[model samples]
Target: MLLELRQLRIQPGQQLLLEDVSWQQFENILAELGEHRAARISYSHGFLEIMVPLPEHEKAKEIIGDLVKILLESRQIAFESLGSTTLKSDRMVQGVEADACFYIQNQAAVIGKNRLDLSIDPPPDLAIEIDLTSRTQLDNYQILGVPELWRYGKQGLKMNVLENGKYVESNFSPTFPGIPIIELINQYVQQSQVSGRTQAIQAFRNWLRDNI
Candidate 1:
């Protein structure tokens, strides 16, 4: 069944949405889409969303990812970057591909494991999201038991923490406690627009070291 989907041409451009899709069907399509496909897929309840991200969306994603890496490195924190990796849980009936995700607090639990089972293994400690063209459902991440979510948009960055199957707005990140996440992220994201990615990251690293 999965092999047959690989032979089919499933060109996903823009956003293709489908409602009332069964979990089995969604999994099959995800399998057919393959690991190397340049697209994003999300499923919540019975709805499925597939999107081919635009240039601006990609730019924001890159800047956030770079900044995250710099933060982790400077803090000497152990992390594993799962770049837009497929995260799904059949039991939760939710699936999502984050812009960028990482295992910080639970890095050791998934360090050498090839396959991750959310039922047993820990979900990504923190997931970064860039909302430019489309909005991701925060409910899905809550259902999947993701601890923290950092949502970036035109207004600025917003941090959310999952609490008893619900998301609560937070000024500080649970992943990096006591850090002024929104202010720091907004400063660099805006700076990247002017100084470019490389220079912005370098400046961020320097600032982080002095402050930490």
Candidate 2:
């Protein structure tokens, strides 16, 4: 069953809803997906979300191709079959759907599967969070073994990438190299809705042609 909670506010009296989907079910689904970097899903404390890091960063632009699809694009949604992979296992870890996830290409990275065992080594290169309800950032990444984490908040986006066993300020993304996510955010902010990816891409092509 797909659980769509826009603003999942879990308090003392509201912990009953989560009991519906056990962690094992989540694990089974991921295991079924086989292998390829699928969206990572996990929920801990009171937060539940999905995380996805494309194996081919270029695939993002291709996936977001054209205007019709772009207009229909959601701020934080997934493709039809691309679904998600969660980190909910045993009684210790809960799962949360990562608003956005970014990971670099590596042998250890989970790729092309319905479900994945993120508990294993080489989690995500970076995971992005647009905090809608939960606030358990401190231990969440550690639990997922993600190298980088960015939590979007009222004060814009704050980034942190693991370095030398410690989380530090991060301005660069290990996944999509040479692309400033901050600029993308600014573009999104500047426009109420993003233009069709095709149109944007065409514009980019034209600009490139003019310059080069």
Candidate 3:
């Protein structure tokens, strides 16, 4: 499997699916892929999906992640940013790698820990995914019980909050309440593309200071 994986050439913005993969095989594949690769993986039941993001996808991810950090810092909230970490639960037979994930309310629980086991530890408070080419599978996140999930794509930003063990679409973010998150993310992410990340982030910080 590892040899075949090495031969697999997935172009950017593309994905490949493999069926009937077991939990041990999934773990082995993750080990083979390592932590520094560009491909992201998601597994559910016996299906495995490997996606390589586009440049546009990564740009949005970094900018939005930075904006989130700024929002948390401005509010003096402590958080741990785990970028593209492989989150898996063997018990549930599910696994996923988020574009960016953060621990806010549960920050203390995972502090200084290098590895997270979702079967025992709480899922990230918020997870962000940039779906430029491939759509993210909501089942893995929903089953994992991530409190907040944000999906950004060509259409716009969509927020999903976990409720009753399922996902409910919302216009507001429970993590950063009372702020126009949809508007802010859409506006600033576009701004970053147009005027560069530094300027866009500075502008957002200024706007946040005045408003919040």
Candidate 4:
């Protein structure tokens, strides 16, 4: 599988799926791919998916992640940003690498840890995915038990909150109560594309000051 991966070239916005992959093979593939690469991987049961994100996918991810950081900072919330870190539970046979993940309520649990073992450590409080290429698998996140998920794509930002082991779409983020997050993210993400990221972020901060 490693040799085949070396020869395979997955273009941006494309995904390669392999079925019947064992857990050991999934670990080996992750080791082979390393952490600095552009491709994102997701494993559920015995299936594996490797996807390369397009430029716009990365752009939206960055801007949205930055916005989340600003929101947290303004609210005086302690948080840790772990960008695209692999979150997997061997016991559940589920694994996923989110575009952006934050340890907000659970920040202290992972403060000094260099590695995460989902079987022991708590899953991220919030996970963000840029679905420009439709590579996100909701089942993977649900099975892993992430509490909150933000998916930004052509349809705009959608927030999914975990309830009773299932995801239910919500307009407000539990992390940022009373802050019209859906409307704010949709408006600012579009603004970033046109007015530039720096300007858009500053504008968002200004809005937060006046409103919140």
Candidate 5:
């Protein structure tokens, strides 16, 4: 069945939606399509979404992930990068695969662990979502108890920090503390596209050294 799903798409980055799917069935599908990183699958309640992200979407994701890593490196912050890993919970019926996620504040808690059971282990301290086509359901992350979410869309990168079990828009990131993440990352991402990734990253590092 997973093999046949490939034939259903006529174009790249196309999206397919499935409704009224059982969690067991969703698990089966997820298992059948194990480790196929090109396709992103998301499940919430009884609905499942399979999407092939466009090159632009992937470009933004990569740059954002890279920028995040650089920031962590600059601050000497220990972090574990869980790149596009599926974070799910059976009990809450909430499942999501982020574009990029990291364990910064909770790094030590899950440093050497293999499998992450959200019921027992802590969730990613920060999750980044790139909204080129499909928008992430922020409410699902709220229920899953993700502390911070960085969503990049038309309005630029907006930080949504979890407060009182709900995400509220914030100007600063709790994880980075006083750093103007939105302005910095947005600048470097565009610079990378034009000046090349290496030069852009070098420029960012230089700027960071001078500023921080």
Candidate 6:
């Protein structure tokens, strides 16, 4: 019994989601990132959600590719976005996870801290959602004051940019120039786990040179 229990512990634990989860409990990230005690999240609304912290754009792609594979294997929903803001809709928002979020650099890219005190306005440039179990608001970018956000769901990928306070349909990103969003998604999905990330990024980059 003791040996069996120990072996079980070595295996990956099943993800636990709140039952009857609305869009309010998306705050699990605060707990995961060790910022729960410090954060002041007034609202969280989503049915399925996860917050991924990345060190760089390269890392972002890597994380995203891994996430895509995981979602497919688990039959979980997922989405990828360039960078936008997360909105705290007072309505039913819970159990949602924004996978591999993207944000444009204000000057030089600054490393995201566990807590981003945006003061008045400092939202990310892009945000992605998998939309596993619920329809978490499709217009989050507009609510959060961001100019653009990419959403991927059961219907595949779609881009929405907020222009003049209204969400507009867009393809190709200034944030990520000349990137065919769908192709990147496919590359990540088709390749091996280890090499998929690197290959996906290379495929998306306008020009890439191999060294060594």
User: Each candidate's TM vs. the true structure?
Assistant: 0.89, 0.51, 0.96, 0.96, 0.92, 0.49
Q: Compare candidates 3 and 6 on lDDT and give the better one.
A: 3
> What lDDT score belongs to each candidate, Candidate 1 first?
0.82, 0.46, 0.92, 0.91, 0.83, 0.42
Count of backbone clashes, every candidate in sequence: 0, 30, 0, 0, 0, 33
TM-score of 1: 0.89
Question: How does candidate 6 fare on TM-score?
Answer: 0.49
After superposing candidate 5, which stretches have Cα over 4 Å from the reference?
A: 1-7, 132-136
**Candidate 4 residue runs with Cα over 4 Å from true position:** 1-3, 132-136
Clashes of 6: 33
Query: On residues 93-157, what C-alpha lDDT tens digit does candidate 2 reach at each position?
Result: 65544544444444234456545455543555555554323345446676666686765544555
Task: Write out the backbone clash pairs for model 3.
Answer: none
Write the candidate numbers in order of decreasing lDDT.
3, 4, 5, 1, 2, 6
Q: State the lDDT at 67 in candidate 5.
A: 88
* Candidate achieving higher lDDT, 1 or 5: 5
**Residue 103 displacement in candidate 5 (angstroms):** 0.5
Clashing pairs in 5: none
Worst 10 residues of 6 by lDDT: 4-13
lDDT of 1 by residue, 47-66 (tens): 88888776767788899888
Clashes of 4: 0
lDDT of 3 by residue, 1-212 (tens): 24568888999988998989999999999999888899999999989999999899899999999999999999999999988888889998889999999999999998888888899999999999998343446989999999999999998899999999989999999999899999999999999989999999999999998999
* lDDT tens digits by residue: candidate 4, 3-104: 567788999999998989999999999999988899999999898999999999999999999999999999899999999999998998989999999999
Query: What is the alpha-carbon lDDT of model 5 when measured against the actual structure?
Result: 0.83
Tens digit of per-residue lDDT, candidate 6, span 24-90? 3344444444432211122333334232222332344454545433433333323323222233433
